[model samples]
Target: MGHVFGAFTVLVCALFGVVITANGITVDVNDEVSIKSAARIVADGLMNYYHGNESGRIPGVFDGGYYWWESGAAWGSMLDYWFFTGDDTYVEVAKEGMLFQVGTDWDYMPKNQTLSLGNDDQGFWGITAMMAAERNFTNPSSDEPQWLALAQAVFNSIALVWDSQYCSGGVRWQKFVFNNGYDYKNSISNGVLFQLGARLQRYTKNETYGYWAEKVWDWESTIGLIDNTTSYVYDGGSIETNCQVLNKIQWTYNMAVYMAGAAYMYNYTESDTWKTRLDNLINTLDVFLYGNTNVLYEPACEPSASCNVDQQSFKAYISRWMGATIQLAPYTYNTLFPMLTTSALAAIRTCNGGLDGVTCGYTWLTGTYDGKYGLGEQMAALEVLQSQLIPYTVAPYTNDTGGTSIGNPNAGTGVLGSQTSSATSQTKDKAGAWIITCVLSAIAILTSIWMAMDGKGEAKKLQEWIRVESNYA
Candidate 1:
């Protein structure tokens, strides 16, 4: 049976000739069997990056350049894989990894992750929890933290820190004051918050989540981070500059997160405002789609080969969110399905890398492997490939519509206590010492500021340096 189906897939691909790659995986856009076959191959390559299932390794994590937050994102992709294909292979590992990281507070703010945790980082994990709930994946035991509660916890925790002191109101890139880019208010942080809130609203029929989602949209638009005219979402800006100067780097993930948020809002309310926002966002996505080919590309860093560890896996979010948007707002299928098909075809063609012959690459427009491989590249291809199966899958579930995850409206309302791990406790102790050091350093810097101000040229140069340093995306 396997040989017969494989041969038939080859014949269909040859006859349709929609897309072909050097790798063993090939897909005929019109054939579900072909897409799933190719997706399974790509999924194998994606999982090759995972070592979290091994003894002594952290659950839900990938080794090498992958950060803590990306592990969460990867599991989210795996959940989509399970939802789309009915595959149970990865479910146990993903569930263990996620449950292990929910922290003492039942939120995703594990003490070890706190040193580098950004609102965006925690938000990614929350998004994954929401996906699990929507997919009706295996539920936790009665005492274990539920998926809906975890999502709500993340939302509540992040929502408390919405800084009104700068950028009017937007979540900072980093959750802690000590982290780099703490002064930056980036789109991904706020976008994730918005997307999470939107999902929560749909799931629980909670208007408070809906209200916060609207507030984020209004602030993003008013601050011009989301361009009202072109509908292009910029990377972010510094609160130090009062967010007056934008970084202006157009990242695919930023747009994709917001697109999902707007789609969910529209789906829940059926209002024209959300409907219009969704339409404009989709219409403007052509910017990331390389010219007439419509294959997704990272505009800021792909051409220059400067994409950082985080930027590399950005397409995974885009592909995943695009699938979510299609399900949320079914009207979008006509406009987005062709783009997804074209992009998926191009994406898999770049998977002919590594000894396994299915390792993927970052740039899909090249139509060949770029020799650059990571969790991001493999995930990007896997998402686009498996997302082709979304149309045949059931729509995401809601509380009233068969969702079973339990909720705790106050899950994230209080301070996060330390977990019982000795390693986590030691890390918190180190963090406390660092905070004191930062205070002393701030005092010393303030003393130098007066001396520098005495010389006009020196003060002007200092201002320029600060502006440039804080402008990072």
Candidate 2:
């Protein structure tokens, strides 16, 4: 048959769109029910990965599970699931990850990963803890070593890596490792820092947090990692290249992470600069990562053999980051929500309902089942589905203009901050530029008119003088 049926499509034919089975749930793409079901499947799948495993660490399908960053990503994703749904089923997984990753001191110094724990690796754990701190736990606060304190410790540890050395002030990709990609300083390492700094500033109102946020933001501009006009963020550079060379690999996660960081900082400071940067980055992201159909396409990977294992999980971050961006910058609702919803629907449409749970495929564009079934792919799918269910809340406005910078979270409007688009913000920016242009043009025209009139008046005076001289003669 020319019409090859997906798992949902086949089930829809028999049941007329009504079923939520343990094997898998099938609902229309737009239905929020789909989001809930997907979240359950993803959480269950994560359990499957760790069920009998002693390490309690998720293995990376693309690389080694012991890779600290990927493990950190899994932890962060779990925490996100908790925050997104306010569910505690995910809390144990997240808690285990937080405690397991810490060194004997309960800090981020992993003994086995000391040589490998670069800025980005540690930053991922910090990101997870940051979320946990925000939730404060819906269940009893029984988790050891308080959430906020743990995040603060990791943030302090990461601060030690900042260098005035190469790339003009970013932590290297590797710390002690020599010539083993240690010379490079990538965006993920710094982008996570920017995110952590912005969020900390939002929560604590500490000036130092704002300072770190801006520092990383400025550093990217100085090093040309971000294109001034195009707003495209490139891969990092090696020391041998003098930080002058850049790898033009534009991964979806890089842009997503930076946009998310910018969005959070914008919300934290309400700075026009951060707002401008966030708008620019979002526009640029649309240019490179999203297709006209409103689905995400890894520009570098999709046209060929598909993304690698490292890249397999990249879209998950992008999806979750965009979800966070929508929460942080209500201005991005128009541009981001449609893309996210459409992409989620496309992603959900690809799930192959079988005994292994609703395993999703990697190719979102075709909605065709991606043959390579890995933990990364499932994690990626779960993230997008979870993103669809949660409605981001904006901090409630306070009458105290001079009050602390931290807005009151408990007093939220709960308005599902998902309407006004970033394009509106851009329009306002353009309006200001337009007003200046109009004023300048009017000034130039008036000056030209005055000059012409002056020239004519001088000529008439000369004529009058000539007439007077002739009469005298």
Candidate 3:
């Protein structure tokens, strides 16, 4: 494949007082040079856990307890890194990892990941693909899947599975019925779809994508996942209860995705409603920001020391999407800069762990290393620090602009299954269908029980494995 390289100046500045070496990273949000220097060190810390480029390792996989899904997110952060800092150091590996994981169908639903794959999981890769297209990242070869097409394929595939039968309308957490969280209708899944649709609409100038974006926003509002008046987004609800029993635990990424989506809508339509929604969503983020400090934190799990591996990384998306929001909604800079810079400063303080003394910890409010480090910690710190370049960079590209990625509107058409018709059902067939449903329900029940007993524990096992792998590496 042909590659494009951007000239990057990775400078190590020892400017007196302008840059302070906090632990192992430079601390100076005021100087772009200092910010990029800090970001480079943090990015290096992040890559320390990545073994994807090794001969025996999977091209896109990370070395730690990171899952197939978060690997995509990690690469997305690298894309952001390259975009923000003009550092092409990781783009070749990023492209390889991203391309290697877009399964034969080109939708990111690689068969190897089918067991644990959730709608949100596939959505993360699609989000990354969309970012590549928007950022005008180095394109793939003629035979490879184009970034826009990959994202569109994911959108179409997930759109086919949008379950109107449950809770009136919402996507399930897991794509397959056999998966553990299939009965849950989560905001992250729907929010991702909304964000993807909004971004595609802006890039393609397509109303169909915009329509889906609107539909998701409306459904989330009607189902009480999003309180439109306050713009407060809750986690999700169980479909078995018809989505009534809500999990009110709010995470930063949930709000970030939807806010970025709304900002895209506002930018595309230049309408008052979307602008108000975007502003309200931004205002509602006070829930994640620490009291008057403007520093970000995970309220649901950070304070209690209970955040799992996945939850530990949620704040990165907040910084990631907020930076994107500034491009689409330029007026938000003054309101958002303080929040981002404040959080970045606090987050860098946690980068005093690991042998290199720059590996970041999870909790930023601690003002010192909390001894935690992984893909989550490093990626979180990289994003918060590199996002300082938001004001210094150009806005993302669209087809009308300089975006070079080729897209297929009907990308996932081949994967869309035909809807079963009730009119053609026979009495015997109906009986058989009922029996099948009953058996599947029993299996689902058993799966739920097993998950309750052991599913989440798999994360711990994976984490331990990753620790061992990193140690050996």
Candidate 4:
């Protein structure tokens, strides 16, 4: 009987341990899947941007023919994928894309000159360059001097346009404006600066880069442009001072870039303060941009009662923002997945499986829906979905299979159809749930084992003491 009890106890303890381990593994797998989906989105987006010729330099005709500026963002996504997956293909894709961006050999650029480097453009390119420098510098193919030089040149141009006055440190819209000493402090411009500073710090190990990043944060924070009161970030600030900026004007693309840049900065600096700031920004933005209430509001044309302009609705803003969020998933915290999932689902519903059906006022009607429908919307959705799926230990149901529909007819009506049944959708939900369950179970089992082990040790000690007493008697 004692032996049986002991064996039972041992089994229970072992089972508990297994549960704990399984739970942890599940959580990690979920995170891995999210990271993978992010990487694939980046790669596919970049490929589309470069090779997609349906309507000129426009990548895909989905999101209302909108220029998502995803190429630079994709680089960051691919870098994250390479880091987590340890896949050479992802690394190669990243290297090739970055090279293509700066390569003078492309048909887009003049043979004598490289791509036209703009501050916003270069800021993003700089991120890709820094990631490349960190990961692929050892490989001869990735050690392209021209790409590095172009990236640096872009940074130099951006730095030259930094205006010290006007609101701490902020970037100009263009180098020409900086050369002329015209510093206009737009939120987008500052967002670019914030990301660039963080990326530079990572690549060069320069404190100044981080310092500049913080400066941008400080400037935005003081103005209440970024969510100082909450944990998430908002969209651009008002064009006119005293014009009421909607707290819920959380555009997806800007928030993604901002969060990604902030997260990257936090990772490199290990700054708890930064992390706190990032958390606050993310929470606030998620509530505003993605919450069920649809808190999104467009910019008012003027503060007067007569100047009420609805501005762009939530759907329009999401078309742009979703792309950015997908690209930055790698650098941000794991909690981003839930928010991303919500957003993707919402987008799919709104567009109803047809890109044209989505009147996001941006990228639509320019490309084929392929089999999934809603080409541009699907592109962004796939990017997010792909990013989430790539790093799992278990295979995620990717919509890579041919017959899946992209949008939903009853989506905005609050009813999702079969597209919800697609492998991508099911796999994402499964992966997330599986990880959560596994991790929680594992933790519970581990705790049980520890308790059982303690009890067994106590029992053994008591037995030894009783035996000694009996022998002495």
RMSD of each: 9.3, 20.0, 11.0, 26.3
Off by over 4 Å in 4: 1-70, 74-97, 103-118, 134-143, 146-152, 178-183, 230-249, 293-334, 344-379, 390-473
Between candidates 1 and 3, the lDDT winner = 1
Writing each residue's lDDT as its tens digit, candidate 2 over 175-225 gives 454324566778888888788778766655554556777888888888988
| Cα lDDT tens digits for candidate 4, 311-384 | 22223323323323333334443555544443333332222222323321111111111232222333444343
Worst 10 residues of 1 by lDDT: 417-426
Estimated TM-score per prediction?
0.85, 0.74, 0.84, 0.50
- Give the better candidate number (2 or 4) by lDDT: 2
Candidate 2 achieves a global lDDT of: 0.61
- Residues 23-139 of candidate 1 have per-residue lDDT tens digits of 677777677788777878888777888887898988777898789999899989889888887879888888998999899888899999877899999999999999998889898
| Candidate 3 runs further than 4 Å off | 1-20, 415-473
- Top lDDT prediction, candidate number: 1
Scored against the true structure, residue 27 in model 4 reaches a CA lDDT of 17
Better of 1 and 2 by lDDT: 1
User: What lDDT score belongs to each candidate, Candidate 1 first?
Assistant: 0.79, 0.61, 0.79, 0.40
lDDT of 3 by residue, 1-473 (tens): 00001000011121222344557677777878888878889888888888889988889988778888889899889999998888899989899989999998888999999989999999999999999999999999877888987887788777767766568887888887667677778999998899998998888776677888999999999999998678899888776578887777688999999999999999999999999999999998789976655778888777767777887788889999998898899999999877787777777767887788888888777665787778888888889888888878988888778887877665664623222211232332234334433443454565456646754344212233234323322
Note the residue pairs that clash in candidate 3: none
